[model samples]
Target: MSEGKKMTSSRRLQLKSLMLQIATKRLEEEKKEVAAAKEAYIIENCPPPDLSGDMAALTEFCKKLHIAIDKIDEGRYDIEAKVQKINKEVRDKQQANCFKL
Candidate 1:
């Protein structure tokens, strides 16, 4: 009947509106979470510099920062090399198994 169709359409619109509101809330929460994560990353990895120091003190601080960066880079390189070695070994073993089969 015409009345039934109208009721169904009204319910559909209400559901759509509710879903849109929920989605908007979820999007806002995700944005806040992302912003928090970025702030934490900056706080952990990008410390604020001591700008009130003399030139010599500033130079020393820079040198220390550079050394820390170099150490992190070396550690990353070592891990990458280990991963490559393991991958190569796995491939070699797989090929050997295929040949045996």
Candidate 2:
């Protein structure tokens, strides 16, 4: 892996950790935006169930809620996968260096 200038495992792990944190924060922001959009869309289209008592409006709200929930879930899964992959690399690098010593 080190043909030229070599990076220590500790340095590689630090860089990967920083990258993971940035990615996680970005995903969190996106999730917040999606939640806000969901709220706005629902309020604009649907009203309180007791006040509106409209089936169509309630269904619209439900659909929008599900859409937002799905997006959030997908984002969480993506972030988790990225974390796992990075963690695996860090673990592997640590193990490789440990065995070398």
Best by TM-score: 1
Each candidate: what lDDT?
0.95, 0.93
Model 1: lDDT of residue 99: 100
Off by over 4 Å in 1: 1-32, 44-46
lDDT by residue for model 2 over 38-86, one digit each (tens)?
9999999977655364888888878888999999999999999999999
lDDT for residue 70 in candidate 1, whole number 0-100: 100
Return the TM-score for each candidate structure: 0.63, 0.49
Q: What is the lDDT of residue 68 in candidate 2?
A: 93
Q: What would you estimate as the lDDT of candidate 2?
A: 0.93
RMSD of candidates 1 onward, in order: 6.0, 14.7
